[model samples]
Target: MPVLLLALIVFLSDQISKLLVRQWLQPNQSVPVLNNIFHLTYINNPGAAFGIFAYQTPLFIILTLAVIGIIIIAYKQFPIHNRLNLKLALALQLGGALGNLLDRIRFGYVVDFLDFRVWPVFNLADVAIVLGVGLIIWELWRKEEKGEAQ
Candidate 1:
């Protein structure tokens, strides 16, 4: 389906960007794209986003695998009608999860860059996952509103 294709695109792009970042930048190297406001700083995150739970590599890896499995089943179970947003959200989450999972398996950590001074440095996978979650939340809110109106 198109959502699956979208997932492929997100996954490939995330992996490719990580590959380039790892090759071009040394660990903890910062190249300012916007003079500290933004930069490409390479960091190998051994934990979840924002560096939380910084020592649970095995648990994170297992949880990621479970999320991937759940998404696959949810995607297939959903009927193809007017649920494009839901589908896309699931696809994105799947892709992002897989991207990070790949890094965790290969390097025992995830490659993160795209530094914004206000927040912790993150990468494309993080972005995709956040956007997907936002979309999912919006869909749920919409459904709740519809039910309320009914």
Candidate 2:
């Protein structure tokens, strides 16, 4: 499947889940999806991951756009086979970034709903970013092992 299509799926799923959570729960309110393990908690993060840059919306917006631009450029430049994983990772990141960017643009904050006590409140976007980054790192590691580059 095309990376863009996968990204769209991720973005749609994330937004739908967020919308449903918002419709059903109030801010700071949570329902136990799994007792003590998971809860649907609502939060508006006016910042980056883990609430960083809590007051830097403009910067965040600019950064997100720059990232999108870079991804588009990379997609055009990179060879298909070598970049399959990279494109997939970028698509996941793009979907996630767009998801929260939509919230930030519309509501002046990113809506986060998934809550795990071991970790701070986060949403699907965060998951995408983390997983995308992890896969990217793994790819790099595998490349080094193969002496493909570096």
Q: Write the per-residue lDDT of candidate 1 for residues 40-119, one digit (tens) a residue.
A: 99999998988999868899999999999988888778563577788889989988998999999898899999899899
lDDT of 2: 0.84
Clashes of 1: 0
Q: Write one digit per residue (lDDT tens) for candidate 2, span 84-141.
A: 7788888899898888788778888888988987888999988998888887898889
* Local error of candidate 1 at residue 24 (angstroms): 1.1
Task: Return the TM-score for each candidate structure.
Answer: 0.93, 0.93
